[model samples]
Target: MAHLPHGRKLNFAAGPSALPLDVLQKAQSEMLNFNGTGISVMEMSHRSADFTEILTQAINNLQDLLDIPSNYKVLFVQGGGTGQFAAVAMNLMRLKPNHSADYFVTGTWSQKAAKEAEKYGKVNYVLPHTKQFKGVPHVNHWNLDNDASYIYYCANETVHGVEFQEPPSHNPDIPIVADMSSNILSKELDISKYGVIYFGAQKNVGPAGVTVVIIREDLLGRAMPSTPAVLDYKILAANNSLYNTPPCYGIYMCGLVFEWLKTHGGIETTAEKSNLKSSALYDIIDNSNEFYHCAVDKEHRSRMNVTFRIGGSNGNENLEKKFLEEAQNLHMIQLKGHRSVGGIRASLYNAVPVEHALKLADFMKDFQRRFGEPEA
Candidate 1:
């Protein structure tokens, strides 16, 4: 096994998940004196020249990685995805006097986003008749109001382990906004397709403090009078996300991650790595002969977080507990699913190495051999 700090265990927990070992090491090396400034990034002033350069380079690196349009302003704000849930509505509701927002509720996060938006304006579910968040259906089947302020959806549903296989069909005039908290930087994206893309840094980007918001030029200056300046896209963009003291340390660490990504061949290569890692576990599930079950519809399975239950009849909780306990004993920790829903969820973010996935897959195969009901 590759040596790790704290003799690190393979982390599979979703959000605040795994970061690249190299990134962590680099952070360690620089924690004491960031670029010869002799102060930890945490101690640096947000308004200082060194930090300004760091912020600028971070933005530049992100623009190059995501192909953010020149007309779009990338702002690093203080809140997480939940914060953007409100900010998206507050900023976009002013698009018209009769403003309304439509949300595609494919999973828990998007559902929460849609609910939070109701506080700012009228919110409608694009697929209210849907029974479950297993997968997305035909986008054309959605009852979309073309003149709506913004059509919102989560690019990846972290909880349900579903992802948009393709961008949803939408009216060209009405902008599409995405909460890409889990899937951002996982793969190449068409930046032009969305008027806005925002993600909390904890998942794939960096740590949890900073939220990156990419807003199209035209979407700015539309914040309602009651909108808090910190939450207003235009105001934050105008002040360069400096309306108040931003997450200095978070931004610095995230910048290091961006640099790591670039050095590791950008998002395309990183995504390839992610895809391979997920398949290592998924292939085991697929071949497990009713011993394992993936609740997500196959077509919509996420490349980041792989969720599954175990056993034949109704999955044996005893077996599940045994699996978790044994896996932890192997130093592969945090394999438990979210409390809201119970099952196993292995988040294979950009930083999780393929070797770790293989080790977990091997462990899973052994568990099934020992505990799985014998084949007929």
Candidate 2:
């Protein structure tokens, strides 16, 4: 196997996370002429038999990895996760027009989802953040509208580094929709618990431009009057996501990723690996002894992304800058925090090898010994 160029750093970006090395090489080999067709996948017509086989393989691979039930339909569409926020509201708000929908606001993304839904129908924000957006509030404290149409939440709040360790139990009759953008396919999930699950492909799945939607079959064709034909689940599902020429290349890449995951022992093994990487990083943070602090609550911390800040009397700006500079010098790129929060973040996605996390942890310990005050 060809190796990466010397001195190339490990990437820790939250979105557009690192892809498997083999997948990239496979794409490179197929870029000029796929299967002797003398054409790139990007140039193939959506209706061509080659592209049709590619789409079918993509869907089949996804279904196999997730073990999706026959009752669910997977649609690969053009919009990103943000577009699904509006699409979900449009298709699923078909209950009696005046009824409200419940939203569990764990962080910024859920809040945005609620705001979009409000334009389509009544929206009730539930489980508000009271303790600095640290974790999901206790379910009993939620003020759910008994007559609401559905309940929505973002399973992994990538920006705040919060994740729901357990699924929420809301009105049983109402469907539960989720945005699993950053954490999808990293672990196993009970698909039956959700009426709809949507994710952007830029994170763990594949590349940008494709959004995967897995919806229960019963929920199709109930779109609101104002819903566009393209956004309607019924139309997309019926046409097998080929309505208006889907993002073919993105879907093909996703298939390659799914195959890679299967060869690596599927979601269970992936979750085990992810747990080890996260534990290694978090152990460093927790043991730093006032030198580093993680903002998210321990129970709700995300395994996919770890956010932390250095300790000091003043803000830790100087230490953060030093860490970034040192990390760059050490060939570690994109370890900076998200703009919404001004602290360091390490996103340990499935594609990031365990050795990468170990190296990062070692760097953190060395940096602390050099810069942090000695314990008295």
Best by lDDT: 1
TM-score to native of every candidate shown = 0.97, 0.96
lDDT of 2 by residue, 1-376 (tens): 1233643568888988888888988999999999999999999999999999999988898899899999999999877988998999899876646657889888878888888888988888888655467887676788888787788989888887999876787778889999998898888998988899999999888999999999999999889878888899999999999888888889989999999999999999999999999999899888888688887889999998898888642238989999999988777878888888778889988888898888889999999999888889
Q: List candidate 1 stretches off by more than 4 Å.
A: 1-6
RMSD of each: 1.4, 2.0
lDDT of 1 by residue, 197-301 (tens): 999999998988899999899999898899988898888888998889999888888888899999989998988988898889889999999798888888899
Candidate 2: Cα lDDT at 267 = 96
Q: Model 2: residues >4 Å from true position, as ranges?
A: 1-7, 129-131, 312-315
In model 2, what is the error at residue 372, expressed in angstroms? 1.0
Best by TM-score: 1
lDDT of each: 0.88, 0.87
lDDT of 1: 0.88
